[model samples]
Target chain A: MNGYAGKILRVNLTTGTFTKEPTPADVARDFIGGRGFGIYFLLKEVPKGADPLGPENKLIISSGPISGMMIPGGGKCDWTTKAPLTGGYAGASMGGHFTAEMRYAGLDSIILEGISPKPVYLFIDNDRIELRDASGLWGKATFEVEKQFKEKLGEEYQIATIGPGGENMVSYACINHDYGRQAGRGGVGAVMGSKKVKAIVLHGTKSIPVADMQAYRKAGMALYKACKDAEGLKEWIRYGTTTVVDWCNQVGALPTRNFSAGSFEGAEGIYGKTMREKIVITDKGCFGCPSPCGKYSRSKKYNSYVEGPEYETIGLMGSNLGIDDIEVVAQANLLCDDLGIDTISAGNSIGWAMECYQKGIFTKKDTDGLDLKFGNVEAIFTLIGKIARKEGFGVLLGEGVKRASKKIGQGTEKFAIHVKGMEQSAYATHNATAMLLAYMTCDVGAHHNRSWAITYDLQVGRDLVVPEKVARVIWLQNFRPMFDVIGGCRLQWVELSIDRDLYVPALEAITGIHRSWEDLEKVGDRIWNMTRMFWARENDGFGREWDLPPARFYEDAPTTGATKGQITKLEDVNRLLDMYYEQRGWDSNGLPTLETIENLGLEAVVA
Target chain B: MTASIRLSDSLKNLLGSEGLFTIEAGHSVREAIVSLGINPDLVAVVSVGDEMQSKDYLIQEGDTVRLLAVIGGG
Candidate 1:
């Protein structure tokens, strides 16, 4: 197939053997690639009720047709597994040159299966694949591991490694690459750790085959041109995702103090402008990117170099934890990246712990004599390392907010601020119905990458629980994740507001498959239903109740901030879900109806 | 009396140049957008200084209004 490396690499850690299989044409046509392929394989191969961190669970790393191509923001890959955190579908997109490198190595997907007797790293130098002993690198941090690999082999070898968090099997441990970019959710790294694999290093020089070389070049150039010509190009490059910090705060969507409030009073200290002025050293980009959003920074206060306290990190670790110093947030970001824990889940977990302490549910004795207060910078830093190592109180925090709150059990679950078992991302959806619904129904739990509709909430009405809001959420859920499927960054289209249609020609030229936004969305809808079914298949009684947001959003209206005195009614929450299910052609219980399953051609797959 | 309006690049593209201009005080953000021959739906957020305001917010003299077209968010 044009634009495909045309192979699936399977590595069995138990036997320390590897095999290469021809990429199945039907799967490629049906599932596309990246996340699409990941979910398809997850359901097809992984058995029912397989332990997420056990050998039965397989980690699928995949790239799409456009990956490694000349198209803008094409350097992305999907790391999918049954989440140790949520025990549901886990698909986290990682940016940088890894996907491009994977494609060059003649692979569409790399599936890691079974547990090894010893620590090892998969080395692939264009088909010279082997499991190299990684005993020395076993307990090292991500940056050190990658740096050692690069220094030993060469800079061309792209490496994805886990730190102590993954080694300890932290529930939200992430796979780190390019120093900072991560497959940053759902314990994908924990799954890898369970398999005794520390890293996957690759260097490939092969050029991808395209259907029409001349047409592909032209289309690729045109796509790049549109990105370059975007009006928001300069601003997007300048501030990256941090550009939304001020905006999120202004609109009262900034998650503050474990989401007890929306906006933060000390927001100015962590604003995008403040971060840029105080710490940002350079703007980093992934492969084939036009407007790089990675703000690499050097925190003088902590003497640390990290790739962002991006908007999510800033909101979660900065405002949500009540620490507004950009340097502090940057340092915390460095710790999470190196320690291999997800900043979102870790921050949310810490926030919950702080709230528990403040509310007198937890004494200093429970917190290891450390003052578990919001804005305790030293405490925050100490907790991050402990979480990664699962030491003392870190053991509880490493379980993530959902599990930690449940274990603690003193009304802390009400402020756990998560949907399903995954911690909610940055957006404080107290009154934003569309965004709240987006978090609730997101396939991988409360992740915002699936559907970012808070802006849409402001566009219409933040408090409106109408069908239009539901429709917008549904549409975004279907469309936005297609970038993950296609193995490219959606931020180009998202931040720059570039015409999405510009990629149609580029895709057609590369894959020789003509598809409009409508056709792509149909595939997205199919993937969505499949993932939903995966969740249901994995967990008993997965339905409407599983889609409910945390109680903090509905029960407690912030006494401060822009959303002060405003709260979504519990009745309205049900109404929104009811409308959403009706719009999505699902049953009242939120399962895909037989008719809807048949409509998406997933009856056989679902059965 | 006038209020300063700072247009994002998206608004500039829609309105065809003029990234910064002065609008009459007392006009709502929606009214200012409409007066500038732009659709109100295209502008997702309007802020006065550091605070976001609804489009119906009355522009005050000396206010520095920033308009943004946030199609999606993180």
Candidate 2:
């Protein structure tokens, strides 16, 4: 009764029916929620090697107990599906009101199954669930579509919608919520589009029941006090991730000019200090997050309200693609949000194309007469449109870097810097072996959120070949993502570095189930093993070979930047994996042994 | 002791000083903040450098500290 909404909303789009079933207590206890429920359902129900875009591929969006509670930054929702992009298990957690709304609506998860004959939108106002016609809303930008929906519906509803990129089934399409926030990776949006559902809206007025309201309130206030007390709180909010721009640039992680260099010459323009001075108008936040990382800005240069060119957008779309103008980057960020593509992958793919064009692999003939080169911001915008439209070379790029490179193999694969089909996230990992290991082993493919190890790499030796670093990455992989399982943001602990123990009382009070950090870590291990099993069963002979970093990080080092002559050797990579496998109690091939699975209680789910 | 404090964008207007300013020790961050002629209640946390510390931390000589304010959030 505490921490759970007690039911799940299952929408079979193929039948145009919405059904609510009481959430099984066993599943709640075993799987927890959010990513846990998602992975469990994905493994059990989705079936092995199912076509990711087909009706058999179900997309489960879920939240955990911590969501919507007054706890500091206790807002995250998990989007899990067999990835249309990677052809593997994908779970992307997002911020904003959707998770909180799910908690308030007395729903633990929203499971979308089968493809609809026509486009439709799922609308739920408390108990009233309906599928509405989505014909007119098919082509609008995510922001525009949401705006239109809010104008038609009321302010109370929160909309998670995709744009033309998703409708077109772009491999890296992301579902956009709260204007800027996203479940952004591995084509979750593409899967939704395949199912012919454009948006899911939830609005509810029911009060969430807490087991111990007094303790919950006290713990929640204490979290706020801790956040309020963080020294970097104000400075951090001022620039958000942009604060790291100068530091990253200085450290040679800026991803300049299609990652040919790590440092950008024009990086100064996009510095946190510069953004604050030039255009950052206000600070924004995710649900219940006291430290607002969202930099909602007004481009006086462009005269428009854009959510941000957050560090990822600034790195991938800006410096990665060789666009230095912060205004341009902000505009690009807005376009990606509106278009519904994951900005990081989109930028990476475009950067790849630009490099190809410059290297004589492509010509004006291949690029639709547009000279696609690094630093051409206008060309970048045009190519983004073309990719969403799936026109010309954009069609090749739309398939994602892996497939594109495979298809255009003429040494082009040499520069395709993605791992497990998903484009690499913001950080350029040439020298940082720990961060490289983090990216390599990340569940969702090359995303940095699961284990942000660059600081660790910097703190320790950057290129040190040691078991401790491997153990650290594994520890982080198990720890950081547990928050997603609980449907909460980890930034309260990650960025603010709060006393993680402070959350124990709040969690216990809210859920009436006392789970210490160790208990939660066990759940995390369970989820990790389950997902690994899913990936192994779904793929042919899934082994250590599949769990590898990009060829560029090994075969080629940057010819420019701070890590100009650096590369992670093949021996070190194998060593890292060997250590990781040993530490995780997995077999030589990276498969979790039956004993480990049974210990984590994942045997039932996997078997 | 000449303890320097950096002001965030919003705090800049409230501080009435454009740049860093010197402060004394022995008092809590809240007390020293009030002594600097800024509202104590308005200040949120007492982060010494990179790490967030309690208000009781002694501001050592030439220590550049920050006093963050709570902003409106979701």
Candidate 3:
């Protein structure tokens, strides 16, 4: 229990009581921590066919063994719930000072179960845990609530709150923390809203226990030094995820105009260098991160401050919506943060609306008389408010693009870009086969964080549907998310290309459990299959069709831009899935075979 | 033969300029990068005109090579 807080806190909002139980040793050994623990609890505690927003569902927040330690980028806290948007497994990785606070409060996981009859907030200060009335804080924006908490409870406390979006139960409403960092996907905030909880505030002063203090300290310092000495340290710290804007645009991976095109003509206006020169005020970071990717910006035009219009926002809100100005995008970012909605989903959903408007599927009467044009800034702002409040047309969009398109039924579903109800993140994978497949089969819907294979797609032939490409996606899916499972950020290794071997000593010293990258990836593989099983258990006939990308990638080729006349053949899409399933030891229908289940040691868990 | 070589912001420190580097063209983009004393490992994606090309892509006479550093994260 050296690296663990060793306690799982269970809060029953319905009864307004809490209990503490020791984290199982076997669970820690098998799952490791973070998302591993998250999936384990989601599968065991939340029963099959439970309504995602109902009292039967539970939200499990967890931290890993490496969390709260001196290791670099050890700030990620995994928030898992049955998704209201997709009705499948949802896990959102939140980064900030929250992870350390959770450990210091002597907790590995905090399970929020049963709905409260009235609005309240959970306060944790060391051993003292209480559910306090949050009547005043309930309807406030996330930033205002965070500011009020900081002023009222002191700066030592870290708070996670939701805005009107969550209160209104927007399917993709997100939990906001540390001003801008969030558990930013998969309707986790909606689940939090459904629980009638406003925020969870924490303040802890205890020291984190480690197995070998001296070795851990030395290894942590060495890791920091290595990060500082990395080749692109200055540039990586300066640009962060924004560095890829020009590259993504140049490579035709940038989503443009509802993904009808790949490259945007106005990409230069919203590129990282332009933002740095225009509005960036400071380089921000999460807990103990040497190479901080968070760019804090102030928009003079909108008179708004935000942490980022990082690459994803730049792609989705800027280019995808056809809004070229970085300041406008930053304002949009602030709006999403304040409204407490996932920007990726919001942008993608709005993009679908814009396309529908352009094609006359949606008329002025449908848009409430605001011209829903792609580049209309005022319309975008108003629609965001509407979506947050679930008003008028925003109600349909708040349901997400997949369901919205299905209800409309104007042959518009083909253009409603999403995979398994969760809208695809910023990458426009029209011709990039591997990336296309990554979005298709990502455990938590169309999110690209699990396996960002666009560069790999470009590297190994974008249009190639070879078995090697499938293997590469599978390998990345197994490797990348181990960072989340271990409660650390992947950017240190992924962006800086740091020697992953550097963490072996640090991890071994902290937890006193020696795990190679191979061992960790094996755990990642197990977590992957376990979540896949959760999806199967929850939804009837959840298999091959659930893993299919939007028809836009295969059916429609961009008539303009970098990917002109290029589209994945539908047959090739099926071929990629076939190869992926084969590589993953799943059957032709993409279900894990019994042999594969036993091979991964998931027989007992699934059974 | 001369080729237009554009370095990403991260690699601009090595080249000491944001403007394109007019380099003596080699057989491949990898060869051209090495000839300029830039570390090949640092370069993630190589582009010729509008398409992403492999590092070993043979450089044509009128090629404009854009080199982006491999620094990427979600």
Candidate 4:
């Protein structure tokens, strides 16, 4: 098939068996690719109520038609599994050259099933795929393991490896790749670690095909031109997502002190400009991306090189922990990356711990004699290491804030700041209803990627719990993730504000499919509804209550900073949910109605 | 007529102002922004005091307007 590697690689680690199957045409045509393929395989193969870390759980990695092509921002890959973190659905989009390599190696998806008898790594050289001994690499840091793989396999190969966090089965452990980028969130790496596969090394020299090669090339070049000519392109490349640090601070959405406040008092020290001036060493890009957002920096204070203290890290680690120093946040970011943990969740869990300590729920005695105070950089660093190793207080924190808060049980769950089991990402949602709903209904938990409607919230009315706000959130939910569905990054349209219509011709030329934004959005809506069904199918008695944002947002107003005395009313929160459920065609309980299911053609997936 | 305008830190250098400043009334926030020689596209969100306002929002007497630069992603 044109624009496809057209093969799915299946490796049964339990029996050391391997097989290759032709990519199913109907699956590709209907679901599109990448995350779509991931969920399709997940729903069909992974039986309901299967243990997430057991042999029944499968890790499916996929790249879409646009992946590895000469298209701008085409480096995204999706890692979908029965999430060990949330125990529902997990689909993490990873950026770098690895997806391209996987495509070139003649793979549309790589499925890892069952548990291995011994530690091993999957080595793929074009069609040569094997499970090699990985005993020596099992416990190593992700960075060290990646370095070892590149050295041993030659630099042409790409590697995705997990560290102690994954090896020890930390719920938020992530897969590290390209020295910096990661398949972060939902503990996909933990699943890989559970299967006793330390890493996947890939090297492929085969050429990727397109239906209309000449049209594809022309369309791709035009895309690059549009991106190059886009306004603020240079500024976007210079700062990446960090560009928003000052903006978020100004708007009181910086997630300071674990969501108690929106603005950080010392936010100036860690703003984008401060970070660029103080620590940023280079601007990095993913494969074929012109507007690169990855800021590679060297922290002189910490004596470390890290990819980011990106906006999320800045808010979660820097400001949320009461840290205003960019260098210290950078070091903490490096600690999480090297240890194979999701910085968003790690920072969040640590922030919760800091709050708990200050609230007297945990004294120094329970904290291993360390003062776990907010802004105590040393304590943050120590706790990260302990969490990665799953030791002491770290073990409890490693469970993520939701479960940890329940275990602590001194009214700490009120401040845990999560939706479902996943900790809330950077944005402080005190009064931003659109963003609050985005987090509340986000399929994979409290992630912001599925729908970032904070800007829309501010542009409309931050506290308005109206149908328009709900509609905006729903539109974004259907629109933003289509990039991942096609194995491309969303920031080109999101950050650059480039003409999204520019992608139409390119997608058509590459895949021979004529899809408008409406058609693509329909697919997005279908994927979203299907994933929501996955959540309902996985959990018993799951309903509207699971969609509620943390009580802190509704109960407590920030007593300081820009959002001082600002809070969303509990009734307004429920009102927003009521509108959102109505707009989404779901019942008040939040389960997809039978008619809604049949309308989306999702009866079979749920069945 | 006059309206108070608040520029974020990133936009302050362009306008040579700190915090809130009153501006001669123009029909709309866009017009007022143009009168100040600032590009409207540079601002991501506009607020009439605490409530959000579109660029086309008519500026009224005693209105305090706030502007934030566009910057966000997942």
Candidate 5:
């Protein structure tokens, strides 16, 4: 139990009962922890076709061996459940002190199940745990609720809570932690809301036992030292994701005017340089993080503090909506964080609606008299609140762009800009076919984290469709998510050229298990197939049709910028998917073949 | 050739009130920034217009240069 906390905490809100079960060593061996454990539990415990928002659905939160250790960017956690929105696999990664706190509490996973009779919050302080009334906090903003908890229970505890949007079960609701950092995406917070669980207030001081303390400490220190010594480390941190804002703008990757074009004329106002000069009050770090990327900003215009209006928000809320004001983007980010919704999804959905209005698909009456136009900061702000409340026309939008478009059908689905029902993250992949395929094949839909091959696309030809390109994406897909599996940030290795080999020693010392990159990649491959299996089991005809980019990538090329009039041909798109499926040992329909499942030892876990 | 170079707050503090400094490029972009009499650590990225380029990248005439300083991260 050296690598694990040796126990699992199961809380049933409906029965108001809590139980602790010893962590299963066999399960731990098969699925290491964090995202790995989360997926495993989501597969086994949650039945297929179960309603994602019902009492039957359970939220499984777990941390991996590397969490809370001295390892570089060691703090990370996994939020996994059946998605309320997609009704498929949902696994969101959270980074903050909460993961580290789990290790200290001597709990490997916390399984929350059954709907409560009323609003309640789980409070844990070492061995003591209680379900307290959350009556007053039910409708409060995420930040305000967290602040209230910090004050009520002392600042020592770390809390993860949802907002009014979640309480109402908005399809894209997210969980907010440490004021700003979120387990964002896939409606995990909606599941919590439907269960009437408002917050998790946890504090612990017990030292996490390691298999070999000296070796672990040494390996961890080496990683930190290398990251600090990295040539780009200082620079990478200077702006974090925001640093790429100017680069995206230059390279035609910035999503402007709801992805109608690649570059934005007014992008300079929202670039990293401008934010650094105008806002950015302080920098915030996760547990034991050396280079903090959370640009905590104080918007003097709003007289409020928001952790980031990072590149995604900059793209989706700023350039995507034609809003140049940094303060406006920052305020929008703050609103999404407090409302307990995914900022990327919220921003993209709103951007899509704005595009619809601009195209004369809807009139001012259809938008509840708000005009729903780009660059209208006031109107955009109003729509965000209405969506969270599921008020007026906003009720249709809260379901997300995929559903919203179908409801508002005027051939609007052509410009939906989603893959497998999830709104695309900030990157405009109009010409970048590899990145487009990456988004399509990502387990959680169009999220960039699974395989951020944009840099690889730049290094190689952006428009090239080849087996090697598919291989590169597959390799990254297997490799990148291992960071989440181990409960650590990928940036230290991704941004900094620090040797990934450094993590091997840290893993061995922590878990007393010798696992090389080859062994780990196999596990990554297994997890990918297992998640794919979950999708196939849950959704009818979950095949090639589901792994699709929005029609816009093929139909409408950028009318402006570097990628003007350049579209990935439909034949080439199919060819890329073919190569990817073949490389992944899947069939033409993109289903994991029986032979592939057997080879990955996932046959038993699949349908 | 005189090209405008904008310095951030941190770099502004280091390089003084002269926000825009025009310098001649000798060997490479790094050399030009170094020639501007600014600390190397204070400069994180050097850009020509909006394009982010490495220190080894060549800077030419009429390029709107931007020198960003390493501030803080996430």
Candidate 6:
């Protein structure tokens, strides 16, 4: 295997034993790597109906063939497991130097199995791997843990650690790496915590083997050149993801006031330009990235240094909570990062709580003497810590908005703003039918990473429920996630608008396999179907009903903002799902038909 | 009649200017972009002041149009 390290490392915590096996060739050929490998193993190995936070649930962390290579934005890896959040399929893409280090260790995937009797961290320095005593590291914040490890083990080592959120097994806890980057969705970190593993430190010096060195070098150089030549490169590096704040606000897609509105009047205070001028100190890049999207900032007012209050955080924590101060958002971002909780989920959960407070569903008695009002900056800070530590009111929030709303009642579930228990990331899809459909059908709940079609919605008609909109969403879902499968970032092609074909030759040279976009999309389709089946198998009666967005999207129109008086009709939502199911070759109930499964060659795999 | 078009940094780089330019009113955003020798497809968002508009939106006199490059969002 030219592009691969050609090994899989399995560590059993209960037995305190580890083993390495050869990476299977057929699996690589069919599934590629990264997310592809993660799902393949999840379905093949993990038994059905296993408790997500129990011993049976395994965490599959994998890097793709292009990882650690000379390819631009090649630092991405995939973490797949049975989700404690959604209780369905959980796969998150993390970008940093961890995947590169994993490749240098001559490993593709590190599978953590069973539960450790005590807290431990997996330590790997080349071939010398051990389950080190992490009793001292347990319950520590992610930054402190990483700092301690880096100080003790030296700077070359890359460490991924969980904070109190994970230690407490918060449903939306995340694994933090490289200070700020995270495998930041679902409950992969909770599963790690459930297994009592606090962190994984890695350092490797091995050179990755490629199929054709000459061709590989040429393709790699061409990629770098294209990225450099891209018109958007400098601007993308400058603003990172924050550039979209104004655009999202303009388009009525910025999540505001717990998604009650699409735009915030205070949006100007947190726009990309404001972030750049006010807080951004450095433009940070992941491993081998040309156009780095990480905006590292230092908030003088808060006296905090954090990687991002990126667009998602700004939308979810800033506008969505009715707090527009970028500095406050940055502090909140730092708090979430240190606590090892997903900011999107934490902010969303807080937003729901605030909305609940505004509706008089709860009083100061419920909030424990704290004003749980929207834009209550002090309360926002307090709740983040409580959520991580699972203290007081935080206990209810730690369970996530979906579960919390279900428990709270009082018509709160209607405005919980989630799809399948995962909080909707930052996009307010009030009238954007395509983007809304994308959120509804995304494999990992309401995450936008799978398919971001809001621009397409603006390009076409935002409120149109035509088949073209549905088709666009489907095409994007299949095409965009190939980057995660290939173990690289899609921003170069996505943000820079570089020719995606540049990757074809690069992949061919590295993998020694000829795959066109069509071929790769076919594989993506297979993986997509496999994940859909995984969801169906894990949950009872999983179908179209489970895919529905919160009632607020169709029922409540924003009283203010750009999307005021605009709403997606409930019938249009169904129509979009109908077209989506038909195009995907699924039944009306949204289950993969037997013929569709056979067509994708997943008969034995699904069975 | 004239309207001002404010290009983002990326668009400014593409067009090689100070980023602020003048365009004739009554022309569609797509046509204005094409007139400036830039591909209409390259611009992902077009806004006039705080309002997002499609490329087909007719430019109005004294309107300050903002154009942003395609952002395959995170």
> Top model by DockQ, which number?
1
Compute DockQ for each candidate against the true complex: 0.28, 0.06, 0.18, 0.13, 0.06, 0.23
Assess candidate 1 and give its lDDT.
Answer: 0.90
Misplaced by over 4 Å in model 2 are B1-74
Q: Alpha carbon lDDT of residue A320, candidate 5?
A: 90
Q: Candidate 3 lDDT, tens digit per residue, A1-607?
A: 8789889999999999999999999999999889999999899889889999999999999999888887899999999999999999999999999988989898999999999999999999999999999998888999999999999889999999999999999999999999999999999999999999999999887776789999999999999988887655666666778877776777788899999989899988898878888999999999989989999999999888899978888899999999999999999899999999999999999999999999999999998897999899999999999999999999999999999999999899999999889999999999999899999999999999999787667655789999998888888899888889888998888776677899999999988999999998899899999989999999999899998888999989998888998999999999999999998999998889999999998888988
lDDT of candidate 6 over A451-547, digit per residue (tens): 9887677666689989888888888888999999999999888777677899999999998998999999999999999999999999999999988
Q: Model 5, A434: alpha-carbon shift in Å? A: 1.0
Docking outcome class, model 4: incorrect
lDDT of 4 by residue, A15-132 (tens): 9999999999899888889999999999989999999999999999999989988888999999999998898899999999999999999999999999999999999999898999
For candidate 2, give the lDDT of residue A572.
Answer: 90
Docking quality level of the chain pair in candidate 5? incorrect
lDDT of 1 at A54: 92
* DockQ measured for candidate 2: 0.06
Candidate 4, superposed: residue stretches over 4 Å from native: B1-72
Tell how far residue A267 is off in model 5, in angstroms: 0.4
Poorest 10 consecutive residues by lDDT, candidate 1 chain B: B8-17
lDDT of each: 0.90, 0.82, 0.89, 0.88, 0.84, 0.91
Give candidate 1 regions above 4 Å deviation.
B1-67
Question: Which predicted model would earn the best lDDT?
Answer: 6
> Which CAPRI level is candidate 3?
incorrect
Candidate 6 segments exceeding 4 Å error: B1-66
User: Which whole-number lDDT from 0 to 100 does residue B22 have in model 1?
Assistant: 87
Q: What share of the true interface contacts does each candidate keep?
A: 0.35, 0.03, 0.25, 0.18, 0.00, 0.32
- What count of clashes does model 1 give? 0
Error of 5 at A479 (Å): 0.7
